[model samples]
Target: MQIKPLIGALGAELLDIDISAPLPPDTLAAVRRALFDYQVIVFRDQKLTLDQHKQFARQFGPLHVHPYILAKPLDGHPEVLRVVKEKDDRRVFGEKWHSDVTFLERPVLGSVLYAIETPSKGGDTLFANMYMAYETLSDGMKAMLEPLTAIHETPVPEVDPATGRPLEPMRLVNKRGEHPVLFTHPETGRKLLYLNTTYVTHFKGMTPEESRPLIDYLCEHATQAAFTCRVRWAPGTVTFWDNRSTQHLPINDYHGERREMHRVTIET
Candidate 1:
């Protein structure tokens, strides 16, 4: 397989490997290495079935089952989240910047998203390099962040997407945890910004109001133009991103068209 850089900051496209079938041992190793090196990797024209998609992701780690999710697991595949946005839907599932499920005690290693159907245009996903975000910070900022821990939570939806049933508070408690602001990538041993606006509410010893300014400042700094890359989607395209080293946002610009994708989150 050939790997081509998608952008200067991060992302690479791997060509000539069909993920529908099991990849050779060396190719799988190469794929893993590319993900670590580039932060984001895409495979085009690989029409992977749900099982095949899970199979490929399982090679990296165990699949994650989202806790108390709004979207139902696709059919019988508990590990796969079938993300769909209809033509008339006002909002998409992941409209904000986040590393998937950061509230979990052990956040996922990464995500494997396979496109089953995509809008004709304008449903691109943007990934920001968190490693670059941490590296570019001033020494004083890094020194301050090194000893800080951010509180994260999974924000529950008001209603279930599949049932339209109003969710009760008892069934909707947020899953909360704490993680260091400057996290060391477990395998790569590199520092990365580990904060996300979606889940993180405050620092360990600070209130939300007290932490807002610094949180906002860091969020703004982390996602600067030079640290990001945009990936366009296709019917058979698959993308994998190292969640520990990146934050991603899915554009909801395809309001007039339908888009469907299957996602599997791999454990670290």
Candidate 2:
């Protein structure tokens, strides 16, 4: 297997490794190392069945089954989590920058997504390099944030369609969880900016008024266009991303077009 870096920021394209066929140990090691360095790795042009996909994902770590969630379980394969957007469904998964499944007490380490069906255009996934996001921070900002902890939650801001009246205010659960604004990657041992605009409500000690400017500035810095890499999908493509060092946004630009992918996440 050969891995080619896609861009200077954070992604790679792997060549000659077929997901359907069993991967040899050395080949898997090379792929794993590339993922650690690039934070996101893409495998192109190989169609992977549900079983084959899950098998490859298992080589990384134990699969994480989301707690407190229910889905139409995929037949015969409990490890493969399905993601589908029907013609009428406007919502797309991963629409915001996040560490996958971080609302859980223990966050997932990484994720593998294989595209089964893709739209002709505009259903891209964008990834940001959190390590670079942290490295670029001013020394002063870094020092100030090192001792701070921010809350993380999974609250959808949308209205409750079931009620005709306006939806009740949604509360961000799991509040007051202190995470360093800067987190160090476990495997690579590199520091990374760790806050998410969607999950982070406020800093630990500051009032909302005090934290607004600092939090807003960090968010904008982390998501700058220069720091992001966008991936356009094709059928039979597989993308594996380390959740510890990166965040992603799935574009909702492909309305009325069918897009489907199966996901398997590694335990943190």
Candidate 3:
């Protein structure tokens, strides 16, 4: 497969590889290397069945079932999560920047998302390179963050009064964990800014009010355009992202259009 860098920040596009079929050992190695180096990889114009998508993701690691409290599993495939936005639906998922499932003690390693349907305009995903976010910090800032731990937690979802179901399909059980503010990547051994606006509520030993300024500053600094790449989706496009080294946001600009995607998460 030919790998082309998508932007200077953190994404690459893989061309000429059919993910539906098993990859040769060398090709798989190359793909893994590209994923580690770039943090996010995209494959466009490829069609894959739900099974094929799960199979491809499993090649990297065992599939992870999202805690049902967070998202319901897709029918017949407990490991796949369906992300849908109806034409009239007002809510959106992943609209805020985050590393998925960080509240778990062992967060997911990565995620594979295949676009089955896409809006006519304005449903792009943005990824920020956390490695860059950490590396560019002043030495004093790095020193302060290196030894600090932060709390991550998902908010409880609101139930709809009419249906008695969650207004959204997902809910967080309020799962919480403490993770290093500057996390060292398991494979690359590179340090990354690991907190997110969505999941990280505060620093371990501080009040949310006290943590506000620093958290807000880091969130804003880490996602500056210079450290990010945007991916515009098309039907049949598949994107794989390393959750450990990057944070993503799904732009919800297409309010009245339909978009659907199937996702599989890889266990770390």
Candidate 4:
């Protein structure tokens, strides 16, 4: 497989490999190395069945079953999660920046997403390199963050603006956990900015009000343009990202357009 960088900081695209078929052991090893090196890798123009997708992801580790998503898993494949937005849907999932499933005590190690349907325009996913975000911080700031742990919780349903009634309840799983503010990569031995706007609510010993300023500052700083890359989606495209070392935001610009994707999360 030929690997090419997608952006200066973090992403790379892999070419000439058909993931629908089994990969050779050496090639799989190379792919794992590239994932750790780049944090996010994309494979374009590939087709995969739901089973094939789950098989490929399981090669990395056992797949994770998302506890809170209301959508049912694909038949016979409990590990696969369907992410779909209909043409008239105005609300979008994953529009905010986050590392997947951070509310779990053992958060997902990584995620593999395969695009089966996409809008004609405006459905790109942005990934930020948290390793770079942490590395670039001032020593004083790094020192302060190293010992801190932050709380992460799954979101509750919002009240509908039209009727002033709560939206249908989403299944609440294990909703909360505390993780280190600076997460160290288990394989790369590098520190990453681990707090996110979506799930992280406060530092361990501080109230939400007291943690607001610093939390806001860190969220803004970690997602700066220089540390990020945007992947424009198309059918037959698959992207894998190390959730431990990066944060992602899916753009919600394509209103009145349909988009569908299948995802598998690997255990860390």
Candidate 5:
């Protein structure tokens, strides 16, 4: 039940508590509170089964079934994504900076990722605080962006010989949506810089070419070291991050080794 802040920016590690067992109402409330207080929370030396993991995450929100088939779900667990990087694979999932599922009408609230097995040297995840990203902007910049809306989009996936084309999450739904460029946190009532490297296409009326300069500048500005924290993974580490307030980048330095993790998305 002890909380240790990992860095000055916005991450913390929970100590002396096992999440596998059923938690009391007050304890669950405290954990949820910590999520808002510190945008990311890491717990080490924990053991949890697939059901146990989902059970704990469901306390926060209903599980999200990912619209894109980026990774296969574990057998019999439709809501859990198996994030595995094989030894021969060149690409690692989530290598760029992004908040989860921004293209959707309602993006997910948070994510809980549990490291099952990790590489010997590197596969850390870096999280940058968007609240800081927005706060640090100049007053003129904030005023200009506060009322603007932006577009978020995901193109159709390429077809493979074996797997086939995958999409239309239980419904052939919208591929693009217009979302407010300036996001206000529902619970905390704080503003955040909502632009992401992956899904954000452009400002509502501008072309991609016209938007690049401002977008590039903001991307470079938001990810500065002062607003970021890195989380190194261990075999039994569990991490929960608030997607509304942070964007994450996964380091793909372990080329020859494998890293396996189980992730659940919380759609509040």
Candidate 6:
């Protein structure tokens, strides 16, 4: 099976790899290497069962479960996360920029998402190349951020699904961390803009007011079109993205329609 890049600009064009079958040795190696280089890879038009999806995800590493999710657990399989958006109950996930499960000390390495049920139109996932975002930063901007650290916190009164109640702050542990302004990827040795608005409430020393402008600026810069890629969903499509070096936003374009996907996040 030969690997073809999907788009002229971004995304991988996978040719003739049966995701339903066991990945061949050479094909698996090629896919792994491509993920590190591209940060986002897509396997188009291969429908696999829930079990097959879980099996393929484990080939990379252990999965990272969402720490704050109060609803249905991943069935003791911490890796598998169910993203379902039904008509009466519509909870859109990851609409904001985020690196998955970054509240953990050792963040998620990557994620594999399978589109189970997709709307006819709309609902695409967007990924930004943090490596490119970092490389293009101005010298003065880099210098200003070198000493800073962002405080990532999962606040109490969580957003509840049923009745939309904000749950009381559970006693939080390992809920916050000081991530460097610039983080280097372990495998590729590439620097990336390491901030996520959802996880990062403020910088270590700066007040919310003081940190707002610069933090917002960097986040906007990191997700600029020049360093970004968008993937439209199809039922059999699977996307594996490097969580350590990429930020993602799931477009909630279809409100009334059902949009469900199965996701497994590899541990970092």
Clashing pairs in 5: none
TM-score of candidate 6 to 2 decimals? 0.90
TM-score of each: 0.95, 0.88, 0.94, 0.95, 0.93, 0.90
Candidate achieving higher lDDT, 1 or 6: 1
Q: Candidate 1, after superposition: displacement of residue 11 in Å?
A: 0.1
**Candidate 1 residue runs with Cα over 4 Å from true position:** 159-170
Scored against the true structure, residue 174 in model 6 reaches a CA lDDT of 45
Per-prediction tally of clashes: 0, 0, 0, 0, 0, 4
**What TM-score would candidate 1 get against the native?**
0.95
Q: Residue by residue across 57-108, what tens digits does model 2's lDDT show? A: 8888899874323233477777777777765666665556777766555657
- Give the C-alpha lDDT of model 3: 0.89
For lDDT, the strongest prediction is: 1
lDDT (C-alpha, whole model) for all candidates? 0.90, 0.78, 0.89, 0.89, 0.87, 0.79
Error of 3 at 195 (Å): 0.4
Off by over 4 Å in 5: 157-174
The sequence of per-residue lDDT tens digits that candidate 6 reaches over residues 25-44 is 88788888989877889888
Q: What is the lDDT of candidate 1?
A: 0.90
State candidate 4's TM-score: 0.95
- What does candidate 2 score on TM? 0.88
Worst 10 residues of 5 by lDDT: 159-168
Q: What is the C-alpha lDDT profile of model 4 across 81-179, one tens digit per residue?
A: 888877877766776889998988886779999999999999899999999899899999999988999999987656532233566763445489889
**Clash tally for model 6:** 4
**Which residue pairs clash within candidate 3?**
none
Candidate achieving higher lDDT, 1 or 2: 1
For candidate 1, the 10 contiguous residues with the lowest summed lDDT are 161-170
Which lDDT tens digits does candidate 3 get at residues 191-268?
899998888888988999999899999999999999999999999999999999999999878977899999999998
lDDT of 2: 0.78
